[model samples]
Every structure is written in structure tokens, then in C-alpha cells.
Target: MDGVNAATTDPLARIAELPGVDEAVAEARTVVDRLLGHRVLRRRSADVSLESALRGAHASAVLDGAEAPLEQVRSGEADDPRVKGALRVSGELGQLVETWPKAPRQALARLHTLAAADGAGADRLGRPRSAAEQAEDPAGLGAPPAPIEVEVRLEALGALLERRSSAPAPVVSAVVHGELMALRPFGWGDGVVARAAERLVLIERGLDPKSLAAPELGHLQRREEYTAGLRAYLTGTPEGVRTWVLHCCAAIADGARDSLATCEALKRG
Candidate 1:
């Protein structure tokens, strides 16, 4: 992921300074510093990574409408296909984030493969859905863009990511997640995959370099609001976009605190 951080020109510089976003970005930086400043977490890196993966998978699965107990999901006793797919993608995030910034298409394909392989069928993994195969977004926002639209938008998104905008990583990441969710390009499992991609931005951008935060958990904790935030992003208005960005910042800050909780849990155990 080091390649993803080449300190390029900040493509998102202007957007970061927009109305409500500056405040959100500032608070996000504070939350990030607070998380990274934890001495106990530095000493327990492995446990932090493990808990992040576990909680992230659990929370993402719930957002996809497959709520399951943490222990059951952890033990592989959760028989739901959605949960199973989210688990696979979340577990593989460490390897995936490394590829995301440098070769976004390749990275995104790999993510779709993992999230869709079990549930969507082995044959369909790693590709967009056919017009015949495209379905309603799991988030129930609307019917997906046509296959051609998906292709065009996806190409644009890949370019945006590869350019590695200097926008605050969290802000860039929120846009990435939003675009993915909006495009719903894949044949299956985009919600979980989108969150994983967002996490990759945070990881590679050094906002949460230890990979110990599960912002997905924050979304799950505020499911209705989270869904509304995404809906607002779909509106494409400036205010709507700012609402989404601020919502994402709050989730990320909550995720930082989630890491603190993981630190407490690991300390106790």
C-alpha cells in the first residue's frame, strides 16, 4: 500500500475545504490521532487486527441484512450466505488494501470475487452483472445502472482512485464507497465489498494504518442513519454530498473508538 501514498497533488483539496466538510475533516483528524496515540494498542497489534477483522465482518454482514451473533460468525456456524461472503472479504482485507491504490481494477475484481464467489456462483466471480442479471441494490436505493452505465462509471472510479487524490483519505474513501454502492456494478455482494474498499483507503492512506478500526461497525450501530446518509449521496447535490461526507467522518471516528473498545477487551482477556 506504500505505493498508494506517493504524496501526489491533492485532487480533492478544494472539496475538502467545502462548507461542512472542513469541520468534519478536522474532527476526523483528531479522532485518528487519538486512536493512533494509544500505547496499549501499539503493544497488541495482532489482537487489534484480529478484532478489527472480526467486528468489521460482523457489522458489514448485518448491514447487508444478515445479522448474526459474533461467536457464531467467528466459529463458522452462521449458515447465512451473505454473512459468509462478508466474512471472506473482511478477512482478506489486509492483502486487498495493498493492491487497491496501485491497481484498483485488479484490486476491485479480487474483492468482488471474494464477496460473490460463494453466494453468486463461482462462474460469476470478479465481473460485472449482465443487464439480464442486474438486480435491485441490496440497500434498496433503486434499480442498478445499466451494464453500460456501470462500466462507464466504474472506469471513471478506477481512474479517480489510481490518480490517488490528495483529498483526506477518509473523504476520498467515503466517495469511493459511495460510488461503488451507487454503481452496484458487480453481479453480487457489493455492499460488503464497498466497505472493505473504504477500509483499504483508510489503511493505505495512513489514517488507520494499523487496520484496527471497523467503521462498518459504526454504520451498523446507526443503520437507519447510515442508510439515509448513503441515500443523500445518491442525490448528487452539494449539500447532499456534504451530508454524506460528514456522516462518514462520524462513522470513522466511532470506528476509532471501536478500536479503543477492542483494546479494552483484549486487555481484559
Candidate 2:
């Protein structure tokens, strides 16, 4: 969080103007709105939110190669360290939501602290990788940025997050997600931290305040597309960025639909 500032230019606003971005965002919003309006939420949002956390953690674990079933996760039978760490991170989101806007770095560190707790040494849990370290390339996205570059970009991103953005929440969240995935700042659990950060943005920015939607599940379902979109984003072209943003929005919509199904099931029984 080195270069944080109260800057005037909204980088995310510019990203929102990219072709088809608005449409995709609008659709995601609509689906989320539908999920929000469900009668189940009015009475049992707490229940839905709890269920969502389980599903989200399970999906995130699967993406990290843990591959636990939802029931296994809920029953506390998924003993993989990655799955357990993901569950830890999911359980902590409510507390971190308030901290995210004020101190994103702290929030991120806490996320990593939880997500990589069992895998990383205690000293390395929240620390970004140094030049001597090699980040895990789970997605096989070539080499991660150098330690210096990761630091600079993270500082700039922190600066951006400290202020209000004219861009939609979807755009901001997508950028945060893509950038972290691309940066791989920490040596372990960077992907889990990145996606959790995106969830915080979507929560803080009013898109899905209760965290009912499991966008991680959407990403899990569309694994190939998610990877391709992230790869496109890493290319640093307008087309690539737009592709990633659209893909993220689609995943969000899919998450909303999944939540809506959850609502239906809860309503029936």
C-alpha cells in the first residue's frame, strides 16, 4: 500500500466504457437484483448467506485443485489444507468487508493469512513474494511480475481503491480480480485472496451486499473460459481487458442464477 493517494482520474471509469462492458454489467446487475428480491432473502438472508459462504469456499477450493464436494465441505469432511484455508477465508469476509475500503492491504494480508495458513510458514503467510521467491503458477500463466513490479502495481491499486470510483462495481471488481491474478503477489494462495478481494468489492460497492452470489462457483463452472479470459487480460490489450471484464460479468450473472436456485430450494423446504 505504498503509493496510495487521492487521485482525480478514475481508471476504472475508463474501463467501464470499453465495448460491451456496460451491457454485460447491466445483465449481471439485473440477475443480482433478482436474487436480492427473492422472498427467501427477506426472511432467511442469514441462511442464504451462510449457504453461499459454504458454496463459495467449496468452489474456490476446487479451483485451487482441492476438489471437495459441497456436502463434504459442509460436513467438515474436506480436509485438504487448501479447502480448509478457503473455508477460513470465507468465514472471515464479514469482518473484512468494513476494513477493505479503508485499508485494502490489511484486508488482503488477512485474506492470505487465512487462505494460505496451513501451506505457508507463519512468517510468510501475509507477505508478498520477494525476488528470490517463485510464485506458484497454478493457472500456468507464465512468470509472475517481478517483486518490484508487483509492489508498484499493488500500491497503485491501493490508491485507486481508497477513493470513490465512477465505474460500476462490476468493473472495479473485475479489474481487482484480474490484476491480482496477473500479479500473483504472494507466493501462495494468491488466487484465493484475489477472488475474495473481488467479493469484498462487490459487497462494498452495493452490487451484492449480503454476499448471496457465489461468483467463484460461476468461475468454477466455466473453468476454461475463466482461464482464457484471465490470460486475455494478462496480454494488456483493450480487447483482452474487455474480454476478461465481460467474462467476469457473465460469471457474476451465473452466480446470481445459482443463488436464485438456492433461494428456491430454501423456500421449498
Who wins the lDDT comparison? 2
TM per candidate: 0.92, 0.95
Query: What's the TM for model 1?
Result: 0.92
Tens digits of lDDT, candidate 1, 136-202: 4667788768899989988888887887776898789888888888888785788988898898899
lDDT of 2 by residue, 1-269 (tens): 22133122677877887899999999999999999999998899999898888888888888877877789889999888889998899899989988999999889999999999998888888888889887987777889999999999999999889977878999999999999999999988888888898898999999999999989988999999999999999999989999999999998999889989999999899
lDDT of 1 at 210: 76
lDDT of 2: 0.90
Candidate 2, residue 70: the lDDT equals 83
Worst 10 residues of 1 by lDDT: 2-11
lDDT values for all models: 0.81, 0.90
Residue 51 lDDT, candidate 2, scale 0-100: 86
Cand. 2 TM to true fold? 0.95
